[model samples]
Target: MKPSTHLVLLLANAASGMAVHDDCKLRFLELKAKRTHRFIVFKIEEKQKQVVVEKVGEPAQSYEDFTACLPDNECRYAVYDFDFVTAENCQKSRIFFIAWSPDTARVRSKMIYASTKERFKRELDGIQVELQATDPTEMGLDVIKSRAN
Candidate 1:
């Protein structure tokens, strides 16, 4: 896949307003955050095995504002940061694997619901390190690993 003109060749979390209907597979880490930002939308090109990372602006203080452009196609994933939040500040402020509902979305926010923050942090951190070490530019990592030349 040809990279986009505006594509930053760098880095990348969670489940939100997300429906449990689609068992969203964590697609290795598609992006890694080079600079700090509030929200992200990965426009996954499934056919081409590529993703376009969109670093969105913030005041991501509201759920609706944060999740307005969330992907529902079962391909791309969304991740967001909530470091600016202080009210119920506990641990995991990051959210990812945001699956949009086919019927009506049911994403879990750390702010609104009782959550498993550590697990999400572990996953996000691991992926961030993994991506930084070896950036996979294509979807054939498995195929290549299998010695399918």
Candidate 2:
């Protein structure tokens, strides 16, 4: 019999050797369900071979604060709860999954981040937008706004 699709996917994930910690999913649920946080920054712990939360933004935090949490020469994964007004003057919000791979980061770090991003993102259930950024300019507020619209 052929391997089931689910089995194949599970095997592929196991092969990657990177795990998303339980808290990562829990925090995402809080943001998605209760709106308790504005953003979450994730980092790969090379020693543990797991992805874990680095920082979390409070509900009152600004977008600039979220941007500041990302480092200048490192790779990170982040999720932002973006709130904006529509053209009709109605309130709207979007969950953005960002892969931050700055050009100056180590090649191995970037490669690992890139390869594991899809699998890691699957753990978050309600992500509405995805952005892969190589520099600050690529993920600037204007860029996120355009994508949200």
Candidate 3:
């Protein structure tokens, strides 16, 4: 093994590690116009298997009249929640959808922010989307788009 070869291998490995670490962030991507915001949720855990839409200005009570949605591997759901775009949480990370996987420790599931509700609905036909909130007083989204079953 040559010294130069070892050095190249080491650098490559380091770069790969960095890419994996930032997989959840999608640092190389940007939100498109009218798409709002987006992020990557590594995996959807069993306990929190649900996708909910928190109405604008609505409270986040389990018994609240909010909509509760679910997703299976064969089904796609449109998420339209505005509670996660705060200056605090949004700055730290971006997580929009959970990656449905069997591995409990799975990480990095890419979720895109498609442009426009009409386009989203049109493209994702046969899929029920979490309609965007129509009012204020709502800031929480219980997006349980995954299930254990």
Candidate 4:
């Protein structure tokens, strides 16, 4: 019998040699359990071969501020605590995992990010939505709103 898809993915991730730093999980727990952060940005440390926390948004930071933290020519992984109101006017919050691979980023960086995204995201336990953006416009407020709804 062929190996299961999950096993294949696990083997692929192991071969990639990119691991998520422990703090990546700790910070995500802070955000998910205590609302300590509005967003968390992550980057792959090429030298260390690990995905590590690059920056974090304060609880009061706006989505625009979160967007501003992302570099125009780099790839990053981010988790945002998004708040929205439903048609019934009830308040709700959702965690979003975003893969930001800008079109202008280096090809190698993009490939590494793409290959490692699922592995990194799996470490964060409470993500409610997932988005892959190749440009800022693709992840704009309107797009987020639509996804949240």
Over 4 Å off, model 2: 1-15
> What is the C-alpha lDDT profile of model 4 across 1-149, one tens digit per residue?
36676655654565378988999999999999999999999999988989999999999999999999999999999999999999999999989999999999986688778888877888899899999999999999999999997
Q: Report the lDDT tens digits of candidate 2 across residue range 1-149.
A: 45676655554555378989999999999999999999999999877988999999999999999999999999999999999999999999999999999999986677778778999999999999999999999999999999998
- What's every prediction's RMSD, in angstroms? 18.4, 6.1, 16.3, 5.1
Model 1 residue-pair collision total? 12
Q: Residue 134 of model 1: what lDDT? A: 13
Give a tens-digit lDDT track for model 3, residues 123-147: 2222223333222212234333221
Q: Report the Cα lDDT for residue 96, model 2.
A: 99
Q: Point out where model 4 deviates above 4 Å.
A: 1-15
lDDT of each: 0.33, 0.92, 0.27, 0.91
Clashes of each: 12, 0, 15, 0
Q: Looking at candidate 1, what is the lDDT of residue 87?
A: 42
What is the Cα-based TM-score of model 3?
0.18
| Residue 72 Cα positional deviation in candidate 3, in Å, after optimal superposition | 2.8
* Model 3, position 78: C-alpha lDDT score: 28
Q: What is the lDDT of residue 79 in candidate 1?
A: 55
How many Å off is the CA of 6 in candidate 3?
45
How much does candidate 4 score in TM-score? 0.90
What local lDDT score does residue 82 receive in model 2, on the 0 to 100 scale?
99
Angstrom error at residue 135, model 4 = 0.7
Deviation (Å) of 132 in candidate 3: 18
